[model samples]
Target: MNTLPIRPEIPWLAPLAGYSDLPFRMLCRAHGAGVTNTEMVSAKGLCYFNRGTSSLLNTHPEDAPLVVQLFGADPDSYHQAMDKTLEMGFRFFDLNAGCPVRKVTKSGSGSRLLENPDRLYAIAEIMVNKAGPGAVGVKTRLGWEKGVDTFLDVAKRLEDIGVAWLTLHPRYGKQLFSGQADWSRLAEVKQAVSIPIVGSGDLYTAEAGVRCLRETGIDAVMFARGAMFDPAIFERFHALMRGEESPPRDGEHLARIVRMHIQYTREFDGSDRSFRKLRSFIPRYAKGLRDIRSLRNELISCETWEALESAASRIREMQPADPLGFDPADVIPD
Candidate 1:
């Protein structure tokens, strides 16, 4: 069987909704993310050529080896979407069977796919057959609810279908981001599957990323909320992996990266849509600033990029403060 075409020991950036844009992906890549997946695309949207869906397919030369994640239950829709993605030069694909949103699950997709194992297996089989071996993988959760070991069976099915790799986030569908992620579940799945397993869920710090790899013995680790708050995480984690001292993340570094992210967004889409798209990110970049609450309100309401830049400039000049009540154990939303 073909294996995942990514490096081991390098942390991955998870495909987050409304956050894993090209600009953010580029930053993480530069910061040492071994691989990055695009935000999940609707298979039906791509089959119909929806304008919004088309925008998600955008890529740059620097973002090579990108994994395009698709969500839907229909085999035909997946086939069509895969065709379009391959034509656009995306070589890696991930089927999202873990999304817990009601709107998605209500349609017999996302985590709901877990309720119907045969159908889920069929989807993986179809994706592998259609996209070709080694080009497709899957990202899924433990099961539809707590206390169910459905994932163990599903993982084996996916391996039987020839999936390149399996990225398991050890949370039940109903669990959402509530409660703790069962790392033991990850270890269980790892033992069950022969293919490479990428462990995810609740990994929000460079230290956690390191520990997960060592404890779970999975092939790789993926960061979602952690990367959003600190794109430099991969770089720092990479340094630690190599037994080297991590570079500093002082005020100047944060300011420079914030500026760069804004510039990249502007270049990607020169419109208010992109401007609004960046509003939520400001707080992430300004996470540890003095009085971040006030700074967040100011940035979230900016109407123009210039205004946004002005807000960012003020944040850069402000004195950096230690994180407010920061807990290394807290898992931020993805």
Candidate 2:
């Protein structure tokens, strides 16, 4: 029998596109994210040798136990992509069957796979065979559309094929990120599968994460937008789970996170593109600050790394207010 590489009790970072880069993963890991995933990579792109895909795979030795998530509609593409990642020394992998973005859905990948359970199972079977038992997992949604309870069947089939774990965000693909994630469906999936079941969706706070773990009896929690708003969510989740008194979010702590993100981004990829990306990200990281609008404006206006660094440093000197952080804006495009 194969076991998951990660401990079920600690929080894992979700495979966020555009946001969960190498630097961001390191930031979360530094703050206590037990396992971090690469941004969803294109299996087809890997086989085609797409230059952009290479950047998504960048990692440091410290970013260990990373899961390289791959999305594609073809088993052949998955076969080749897994080969490349295994050769690259990635020990863990995930099938991205949960993304509901229009681009991914239109390609017959992502949550679109939920519509064709046979095809999804075929692809998952190939991944497990190629990667070996306990090396592969699948992330998915409740179903392709509302009124469809497609998750339970899909979860059972994937488990039968020996995929190591399942990360479920309980909402229809068509629903995207709208409305509430029906966590009741999580209990149903958990009862259906014998393997580890990791719960996702609406886990935007440490309290919610702890509540979900207790209420649903799932194996672990994977933080998405919650971790985005505050990378320390992983640490906070653990603290709350253990009944330990966690520290409140403060300027000094937030400042450290910003500084570390900047240093890691510079160390990994400091080109103008990376700099501009960091400029956009700092405001999100600062959502818990007392004056988000003013801070947001300042960050958006920054033209140089020096100016941005100056603004971020000022955060350390100010006292903070939001208990955890601003609820991450729902407007995030995933």
Which residue pairs come into collision in candidate 1?
Answer: none
Against the true structure, candidate 1 has what lDDT? 0.81
For residues 245-278, could you state the per-residue lDDT of candidate 2 as single tens digits? 7657888888898999989988998889999999
The backbone clash count of each candidate, in order, is 0, 0
| Cα error, candidate 1, residue 83 (Å) | 1.8
Q: Which regions of candidate 2 deviate over 4 angstroms?
A: 1-3, 319-325, 331-334
The top-ranked prediction according to lDDT is 2
User: On a 0 to 100 scale, what is the lDDT of residue 215 in model 2?
Assistant: 88
Could you tell me the TM-score of candidate 1?
Answer: 0.93
Tell me the tens digit of each residue's lDDT in model 1 across 28-130: 8877887899998999899998889998877898886688988988877877887788788777889889988887898988888999888888878877887
lDDT, each prediction: 0.81, 0.86
